[model samples]
Target: MIQTIAFYLFAGLMILSGVLTIMARNPVHSVLWLILAFFNAAGLMVLVGAEFLAMLLVVVYVGAVAVLFLFVVMMLDIDFASMRAGFMKNFPLGIAIALVLLAELVLGIGAYRAGALALGTPDGSAAPIVGVSNIQSLGALLYGPYIFLFEMAGVILLVAMVGAIVLTHREQKSVRGHQNIQKQVRRNPDEAVVMKQPTIGKGIEL
Candidate 1:
């Protein structure tokens, strides 16, 4: 009874927050609402006995992704009124597209319910699968079955990261980087220092 009540409460809160996340005028407020939705989704996951998923949703989604969204929304100089005007202009087209998407989703669900689509086995069935544990299964699939694909993905990501660095990299004539490192490593006191006797009031010029 307690679990059921908690589930309903969390589900309601999640839905409410999700609606608010889309409906809020302010981007920052939308991010806050999204965070609230994540929190409630985590609660729902916990209620369903998926503690690992709940923790991932809370720690990763809420803690990291939502925070990053909040920071981006806060830092960005977006003209919300202008965006709203643009959205208003495109509202009818967007609604028509959304309705089409909704219809497609409903058709897909109906097909799925009627067993027309061949999805994988149901949640818990007595099948002799290799690894049932989340981390273990993910690791086995990543390193064993899809190792080549994984390596290719890593290479692609590496290329993208290097491309980003190359795009943002700039050379300045005033900023000496490599020369300073070389000079520091091979620095000699005799070359850098001078010993001279000077009068108390007069400074000696090097």
Candidate 2:
């Protein structure tokens, strides 16, 4: 079937791109590979009937996050030789983190296999509405039951962005041509501008 072939194609490409993303020496190339992986993952999501997720993968991950990452990698002056020199120093820490991640994955799999969690049976309430598009159903579910949580997340992100700006912002008294909106707003027009009335034949002195 075409679906099967497409699924395999997407999956294979996604896996290959993921490997390339990690293996590429150039950070910019790695980001490009990452974007490719995101595209293939989006394709897989479409094949799995989760079109909403596919759109999010392409729009958010590929469009925004990956582009931002590529720009950051390209802008930075990375010393690859120096980084490679420090690899052995950081190898033990990396190995420890990897082991921790592996242990977490094993625990998650064991718990899933044990099936001890008593999640309540799905009453048709959470199910997608008949004859509705995937995006519509997902939007309804998110807005209907999770509106407050969604708003809270937005607020948190807004606060975090503002906080980052505040933390990084430095007022420069030594720098010329700095903008002071409040100072400009409160200035008297008479002090800033003078009415010059001179005699017809006399030159006005500044």
Candidate 3:
């Protein structure tokens, strides 16, 4: 009974937060609502005995991704009106896509209620090495069986980070405040500072 109540509560919150995220006026507020949705979704995962998945949702989506989105929305000088300029123009296309998604969701739920479709049975080569905790079990599965795939995912993320940095970075010749690291490093103490000793009453001049 307690589990059912918790499940319903979290599910409702998840749905509500997701709606609010989309309908929010402020982009920052939308990100905050998205984070709330992530938390509620994580709670639902916890209720379903997927504690590791819940933790990953909280840590990755809520902690990092959502927070980063919020920061980006707040810091970036984006014209929200300009961004939403094509809303009316794209309204029909958006509506069609949304309807298609809703239809798919209904079909999926109906199919699930009838019977779950079997995805695939794991090959015996990658057998599970049971550990004390779910996290440990997951780590064993990821590092032992799917280590190469995991490493490749890391490399992909590294390349993506580099790509993002390169895309956003602009070299402006008009910006006079740029620092020259090599020039600063090559400077001597003599050029940086002039050793000048002035008397108590008289000042020393060139």
Give the winner by lDDT.
2
Top-TM-score candidate index: 2
- Candidate order, TM-score descending: 2, 3, 1
Q: Which ten residues in a row have the lowest lDDT in candidate 2?
A: 189-198
Q: Count the backbone clashes (under 3 Å) in each candidate.
A: 0, 0, 0
Q: Candidate 2 has which clashing residue pairs, if any?
A: none
Q: Across residues 27-65, which tens digit of lDDT does each residue of candidate 3 receive?
A: 988998899999999999888777999999999988899
> In candidate 1, residue 128 scores what lDDT?
29
Please write out the lDDT profile of model 1 over residues 1-206, one tens digit for every residue: 99999999999999999999888999899999999999999999888867778889999998999999999889989999998999899999999999999999999999999989998765543322464755555566678767999999999999998999999899866554445766588888766757679899887746
Clashing pairs in 1: none
Instruction: Report the C-alpha lDDT of model 2 over 54-133, residue by residue, as the tens digit.
Output: 99999999999999998888888999878766876898999999999999999888887899555578788889989999
| Candidates in order: C-alpha RMSD to true structure | 7.5, 8.2, 7.4
Off by over 4 Å in 2: 114-120, 172-206
After superposition on all CA atoms, how large is the RMSD of candidate 2?
A: 8.2
